[model samples]
Target chain A: MTAPARTTSAAMLDEIRFDAAGLVPVIAQQHDSGEILMMAWMNRDAVAETLATGRVCYWSRSRAALWRKGETSSQVQRLIELRLDCDGDTLLALVDQTGVACHTGRRSCFFRAARDGDWQVIAAVETPPDELYGDR
Target chain B: MTAPARTTSAAMLDEIRFDAAGLVPVIAQQHDSGEILMMAWMNRDAVAETLATGRVCYWSRSRAALWRKGETSSQVQRLIELRLDCDGDTLLALVDQTGVACHTGRRSCFFRAARDGDWQVIAAVETPPDELYGDR
Candidate 1:
């Protein structure tokens, strides 16, 4: 879709836009160090919560509720910066994360080995569900 | 944009499809456990690499190259399962990750703390750039 023109200042809220889904693509990054953390979807409420509360909030399609990153496992993400792409359909959220981002107990959920031409399993962290989430 | 109908399966290639960018959204999960890891983008080549070598591979838009997860810091990921959403635009990769996923050295990149109405920096893992990049 060919979008309208974009402005560089926060006063250009008229130019900044979101999709029909009321959701924007958010790219999570590590603050202070400036490292990319992860990418997720956020709606207006999620955006508001993130900005107002400083915690990373995501609209969970599966749960159909607002999901605070690292809620269950005590892992938390603090917001550093909220950036909008030129089109304003995408966002970049610089955050400071805690504990593990992935449910598997690793720092991130992107832990797969790609080598030669095959997808292989390499390393893993976290205890099995039988132990960690047995009650659930 | 409303997408067309697509096939859905979990039998590797039979389950997922990619866009013109040759990339698919991969959701990572912990290996030894069934924790939802982080989500990332992977191109067909990256998928092929992961399947071929058992290592996690991702397309680095910044470096414009193929990135093997944990290639630099000895923090590797092993693929457990590859799942596809009904839309075929998304992929769920079950993996086992080693070491830290975030560059900051924490187990994850999402380490921010949210309290009251403020986002605060909390924990951070320290990693030497040389250890990860090797003077690249």
Candidate 2:
């Protein structure tokens, strides 16, 4: 599908009911496959930049700044669509993900399944973690 | 698919990495169709309770208490499998959802899709808000 329309960041930003911390939770999913890649936080600026650039941006709680996905890992997520829930407190970004979405080198961050009364690693690491973050 | 193994709520709870507020974000999804329902927060007690009992429970930030899904609306979500992301900060609960998941009576809270530079309602409300929250 075509990417979400641009030129409406201001209108879109107004609809988001950001939390007291000025951040909102965002879920990123693989656009074509419908597979959820990861969950992250986005502030007003991050959301605006993503809509402005068609590239996913998030708020790094640790860095306290804008976080562009794949900035260091080269696992960029190109925004295909952006969605807001009924409450406007949450967002869903449909994106075209490159390589693995997990820092652990897994296709997605959700690789561990609760099974047999414990956590089980259900998915294998597609790429080595060292290779993904070798520069860092 | 069969439901996930139970009998280890304590062990499961230990793996969760809740935030400073003692809560973690949980995404609920339709297990059979792979459709995302909604996102909610869960505390340690809520997570344990969900595993102990097959029902999904959330930490209501507003109510400052346990919020059971469908407690009033009867749109329950039965846990099919729970997965933890690689970071242990977020969770994915695959569930067999009954009735509607959104308070607005939409099957999913993600009914609004960004299209043509604005939000578009893609999914119609399956049930009316009055009927869902009438008892309240």
| Candidate No. with top lDDT | 2
C-alpha-based local distance difference test score of model 2 = 0.89
Q: What DockQ does candidate 1 have relative to the true complex?
A: 0.05
Name the best candidate (by TM-score): 2
**Model 2 chain A — which ten-residue stretch has the worst lDDT?**
A1-10
- Predict model 1's lDDT versus the native: 0.59
How far in Å is the alpha carbon of A22 misplaced in model 2? 1.3
- lDDT for B133 (candidate 1): 57
**Candidate 2 C-alpha lDDT tens digits along A56-134:** 9999999999999998889999988889999999999989999999989999999988887889999999889888889
Q: What's the lDDT for residue B118 in model 1?
A: 38
What's the lDDT for all of these models?
0.59, 0.89
Off by over 4 Å in 1: A1-40, A43-46, A49-136, B1-15, B33-37, B126-130, B134-136
